[model samples]
Target chain A: MPPKSTKSNQSTGVTSPSGYLLTCDPPMKQFIINLNDKKSADKKFILEDLDATHLLIKGDVRDEITRKVDEWMDENVFSTIERVGENLDTS
Target chain B: MHQNWEQKISSYFSCSQVQNVLVMPAPSKRKRAGDASSTASKVGRSSADSSASSAANTATQAASELTKIDPQEELLSTSKSLFEYLERLPPGTLRSIYNLPPPGGATVAAAVLRSSSLTDIARQCALRLVACGGKFKVGSIVEKWIQRHGQRDALLALRRLESMGILEPLGLANRPGQGNDDIDDEANDSEKRAKLMAKIACLTPEFKGAMKLHLSTMSSSPWPTIAREQIEEFKKSGGGAKSDGGEKESRDPPAPYELELYTQSSWDSVLHFLVGSDEAGKDKGGVEEPPEVMIQFLTRIGLMQEDPDYNGADRSRAPLVITSKGYEFMLRDTNAQVWQFVLQYLNSLAHHNMKDAIRMEALSFLICLGSCRVGEGYFNSVLQSKSARILMKDLARFGLLFVCRVAGKKAFYPTRVAVNLVASNEKEGSRQTDAIGQSVAATRSLEESLSAPVPSRSHLAVVVQTNFQVVAYTTSKLHISTLALFCDVESYRRLPNVIFFHITRDSIRSAFRLGVKADQILRFLHVHAHPMLRNGDHQLVPSNVTDQILLWDRERRRVVMDEVWAHQCRDSSEFAAVGQYASDLDALAWGNAHTNKLYVHFGKSEMVYAYIRKWRTKHYNS
Candidate 1:
């Protein structure tokens, strides 16, 4: 089972859309993740699997998680633009 | 080449700094914030938008740098953080969390985290995979969290993770009874996945059951519920062919026996080259020897001393002799042998004060390759920089990596030697010998037709006789050269696969002069003893030979050698003062009170002379 949303609330008050918590108060150190998927959940769906991953970060999870999400999004945009540029050159 | 005694003595104590060397910048200065993101971008962002709050920038900067260097450094620091996290919890919660076994996923998990160039994605992927028990379908991960937006990046991320040992390709053998564990020869990918669907999973090296246990017990938010029925389905139908549950899981395919022979010969030639032995001139059968760059590296590290009479104008005629250090190095285990050179190279960089970040990048890259699957292709990624490419090329020359270049593209593969170099071999006592034994076992199982002529196993071919005679059962040029270190080869026989040699007092003494200790000789003999003579539990060589070798060693060490000068004083009182001064300077070799004479060693004689000359002047002036 994914870490209980209740457990995350009790530990770090930072809340996300699907009960994911990223707190930076105690410094996110290490978290154990379960890579196996739930059978009842839509195995073919997208974004739902993010809730399947448990995150343990150092300090307050709020700040670190926000920064991480923002950085990841930026990477996606940057790579997409670079791919476009490569396509233009190839064509 | 005699020198003046005064000048020689002074020179021995002098300290001089060589000024012509390049110094590298500090690591922190090179760790620029947003460098990872910025490197990928062509159009620059405005300064106002680029300049984030200093704290946030530094945190990201630190994270980026940590990923570049040792990926395990983050795991180590985070584990420490977890320990602290556990300490702050209430007693009841703490007790429950503590009761759960520690997650045994550090090394493999750390490698997965290092797989991605972007820190955030790597972290998320690693966390989820570990929670799911280190096994996930590649398709599941790609479709669920990483599609549509950054699909290419996500795919590349998975490939990188697979190459770095995080996700293993579950071939026919990984399942319960499909593959015969007795055979180690690698099957082609097509042959492995011919009828079955491609299955990939995160696995800890040498430990899968423990990882599963830890994941099952983990109950926390964000850990998805694992379907027991689905897992049972995978476990039952995963393997292609079902048989009697007797086949052992083969972790990795062993390289062909010829590769082992090639690696050994190349390394041994370098050592043989130092001992000034004719074994270096032996047959190569067309395979190339290790490059001259390795010889130069040994010379640079003070392991091999260059010939003083050699001329640089005749570059091809350069000759080098093994120094005392090199002789000692010969007896070290193979891992240690490689490390001695790598450590020396790293130290040379440090000696020049090369930038810590650059040094760390090179060091961590090499270490990371240890876990990478052999024969896998890694396209341009983190190792795209010119320096990184050059370093990889240099390592390839040493036979640590086999670089395959095809039509302007290069894919590097780690050889058995490279994998062995970085294997965290934890078992102590005779493990190197066991490594040799395992190599032989692999060779035996690989080819039976070519077994008689080539000595199937490198480790199983040596036999030690009670009469101080050694017989090595192999045709490997490397084995022959290593045996020549302290033995006289009597004959090379083909039928029974044996090369005979006799150990003598003179040979052992000569080797000792070159700094090969008695213990090292014994260890070599023990580790390389024939599989027949080396009964798993007993001593390898005869006790008489070991005892005689030690006795010969003890005989030589009984005498002391030193350079000293005897000085006569005007009186016993003056002699006492002079002797006291010599003793204080640590130069007094011997003192005779009756004769008013004192002896001083050559190195500290200058200090002794200055002190006595001043004393005499003071006595006369008074």
Candidate 2:
């Protein structure tokens, strides 16, 4: 949902540089994480609109951790990043 | 006279040195027993006590005569000859006059452009002073910024000022601590204490670092009394002392930390002693762990900054800098912050200063730390390469970095405390919706990001939710708890998760406590409503309802602050150092967040003595 990275703006856009990234997924969701930011989306439904709040992570490494948080993942990523719905009982 | 004193012709090293110390990260010359500023102050006071008239005449006549026969041709480097310009002016307009750009223009770049090394920056500043007709005591523009900026950067700025011959030393006249046995043989205890305090108040950057090492090393024991005594002495003597004596005495006694006296525990004390360099708290020296990185993060983010009340900007386009406030909050999430600074520092180290084998090995170990992923697989990588293999073997041997050659990368896991530190901080950083939303109200923007402010708390939790799922991408359990406490935690999942819960009043209320964007909870719920509701046009959550719930969440949120040392010693070397006293080291990291004062624990027993003796014979003299 966010704009892709541009070559000119080193700080902006999607990036996959050489380094370690964390990826965890099972039968439910898939999330790939890099030190800079993340990407995620739901599998079952496609949305017409999702604000910047739902799309990108816009802070430095530390800022992202303390504030400015967002990560894109598979819509069905069963973990917390994908959970939603009415009657979603936590009993 | 000519036979007794040989004139050593000091030549500018087209960037060369005698023993070629690693030019990149070479350290500095500390405060000594008899520096020139101390001598000058002594002369001023003695003259005041005798006849001010005689003293003034003697100095005037001498100064007048020296102008005729000035030997040193030192060219002052600073763009401003403000001190000389204001020699006859009143004090009221002195500040404004000096701060103004010269009619000529700012020549800071031309004054400092040549030498590549920080050493040269220091020396060039010195040479500039010589260039300025041998009077290096020009009013410095760099002073306030150095004292009031991020520690590392402040030191760099300070070092430059010192080079240009402009810094004034704090009255750090050496004296014994309260319990040192040599009290009676020296000056009056109370008088010496006053001197020590005054000295500490105006301490040069290096001695100030010595003071920190002393405090940390003396953490245990009846420290409140000792610290209070020293701090009170400084205050009474008109010293602008930093935060002092609010900490509880460590249950275990403190190890004594003295630069020269307590020859024991010198090894451990030296690392921290370096904290005195203007770079102390802001992370310039080699740090012990990943949390050191968090300090760097706090600086990078808008948390660290000079209070707008303090620094006014100049029209210079150089590296963006963090202010004093940025450095303060940096110590708030102390452990994580320490790591953040250390990581960037290690990265910086990689670019330069890899000359010594030991340093090169240390550099590689740090790079390995940066290069590795956060999860179990990468953490458990095979120990390959002789340097890394040796390092990894030692890490596992000491329980720092674990390995699983068979799984290749899937065998190890940083403990809850370990993984949550700065090494994994950036990973969990993206997941910090709570921190982001909360810090928004508190954080300074852009340049201010490097300077910390009064560490904020009321707004730090904005998006964390129950069931161990953080709103942001972070995997920090502490953040998870920030969210989980109010709501029903569904299950413990290793990774981040998103919940599709019903938009109930209670759920919305709980979400509000996490932070402001929190107003979006109702909307968050609406978008993920039941299948039947999803088909309808009410995709946006109701505004008033969202606002109410967010307000409720704010009402419910509470912050629990951690002391500076609530972190583990995860480095192989430090762990090995700890292995000799594992239980004590672990206690230092966990027990009192402020009590990460390892030297104190070691001081009480054989630990401090042993380490000090070993270090003095090795590090101190070296």
Candidate 3:
């Protein structure tokens, strides 16, 4: 089943709720999940994995997480030129 | 005084002016003769001869009596006498009588007359009349002239010139009333019959003055002389006539269809590059690649974007990918696409700090080209400004003109695409473009290799099955690549005439990631459906397949994220009150009465807070 948005808050009986909005594609969501798993409980940035393409995370770490994603995309996503080169070599 | 009278009397008798007086009896016997002699004295004062005056008076008396006898005869005799009087006038006097002053001052009248540019037919008609001394009977003579010149629409040309004040009607033949009735009755007759009604026309004084100035300026100008010299130099250096006859043979200008093919091939290369077809770079022999400036322009307009994953290692080598906007642009008909490109080019000119006059000239030149005949060639020297000539070259690069050189004479033909540039009717414009496309395709198939495909034939049909299988009946590499964007390529197969592929979940999700919407895909398929499927009663693409595609697209978009302030209330009643206030403010994001929780959108959070404070204070104070 697809992961749905988490409705139940973790802090019971709290008067106010706060979190940061994180939007990314499903693959990026998986990356965030792996990052959460690698970190200690206190250092985990994610408050909730809301759905396939969204996350509820600690507001202070939002910029750091976004920078990491950018770095990852730069390293992992192949440019069109490289892809064309690869196709040429394979053909 | 007696000698002068005798001289005048002898002259009038010798000229036969006193025939009536000679025939009349003595003045005492004829009262009319006495009246004629009295009238003659008044006419003789300018000539200074009494007997001559008496003879002239007798002629007038005879004319009046003849008028009393017969009106037609009176008109005939009066006209004959008038003609004789005119013939006797000296040449200098006649010249002075006909040379009327222009209505307005010469310069102002000339400017006003030349301000409105004439249509081709009207210009030809004006030039013909001016050559014929600017006055002609406007019936069979003008009609025959128009026919001899091979101008079919003589009536339209005449009316146009008449409206422009270049020609004025002197008088109509036949009686004035009868002419008016004929005009009214023959208003709907064929042009030939209507043109038979004789009328006299002359060039207006303003037009004549303007033409004189124009001719004088044209002859005195140094520009045409310089241009002639330049053409001679070009001929000598460019191997026009003095070249070895073997390789430098002069050829006739390209026909309209050939120009269309050239234009389509150039344009197709640009589109293929945008689509990132594998064949784009390989097909350089027949098609010219779009210039670097155009590629940069595409990026600037957000149609294609530089790949974000490039790490700025080599800027020039950076790969540009078609953005979602570019994909959408590809779906538009040729005319709309060309217009968008042209408008964007104009906008880029403004951004590049081009002079206002040059930009306006370019726009007007485009409008003029739009009205030009498709196959006709216009001299390149007609573009007077240096910047306008450069613009002509640029437009040629854009497939809007076919620049040709024959015997050192450079001329440009506006292609079918260029001629239809300013077409206002959307349906007709697309139809014309499609016809050109079909013709180009038909010709290319004859000369191109069997494996090669013509990308200009954009409307080639595609067939889709209920089981997600797709069959596209086209050999175009551009079309295949575009389909590969959203189709499972693992199962893709290509043949000489058709390509086969399958739509899969992973491929669609990847397409969604690229910002392509399911509706755009569905629209593309519907528009390019196979003719067989289009004519059938069933849906173009199976209904279940379309539904599944929509469902797949909807799955990833379920999450809605908004910034909000969450509030946990003490009781359901408190939650209800706060929720109602937030809802009234249209800032309520979500609320659960059972849990006594409510969320207000971030923008209106302070207002909700103020309301809550006011409510608590009121309840506690009361």
The number of the candidate with the highest lDDT is: 3
| Candidate 3 lDDT tens digits, B1-622 | 4344333322222223422322111122134323654433322111212233444453334323322433432232222112222223232332322232321123222322332233456676676677788877767544576666432355555654564456764322232113244443344466735554456667776566556655555332111222345545566676565546554454457765577556666677678878876665453342333443455446645787766677766544456777888977775545456666665454433322232344445554665565456666767776765555656776776778877664455667777776665433223313232332333332343234223454334335678887787888776777787788788887666655777778877787788878888876776676566655534586878998799789878766433345667777766766888889999999886666677867677777778877876665565457
Candidate 1 docks at the CAPRI level of incorrect
Candidates' lDDT values, in order? 0.46, 0.28, 0.55
- List, for all models, the DockQ compared with the true complex: 0.00, 0.01, 0.08
* lDDT string, candidate 3, A1-91, tens digits: 2111242342232234356556667877888788778998889887755557767777677666656665665475342311211222223
Per-prediction fnat: 0.00, 0.00, 0.14
- Best model per TM-score: 3
Q: How many pairs collide in each candidate, listed in order?
A: 35, 113, 1
TM-scores vs. true structure, each candidate: 0.42, 0.20, 0.44
lDDT of 1 by residue, B1-622 (tens): 1223222211111111111011111121123222532321211111111224442243234323433434323222232112121222222332222122233132222332433222455456655776777777655665576666464455445543443334454332221123333222322244533322245556544224333444465442111222345335545664423323554331122245544544554455456555555544334342222233344356555676655666667433345656788777777655556655554344333312233433444444554455554433343333644545555655554556654432122345555666555442322222445455445533443334235555542333556767776767665555566676777543323335556667776677677876788888887776566555534666677788889889878755332334455456878867988888888778876666777766666666667766766776677557
Evaluated against the true structure, the overall lDDT of model 2 is: 0.28
The ten-residue window of minimal lDDT in model 3 chain B covers B41-50
lDDT tens digits by residue: candidate 2, B410-513: 23322222222323333332443222112221222211321225321111122333332333222223333333433345433332223221233344334343
Residue B322 C-alpha lDDT in model 3 = 78
Interface RMSD of each: 37.9, 21.5, 13.6
Task: Supply candidate 1's per-residue lDDT for B248.
Answer: 30
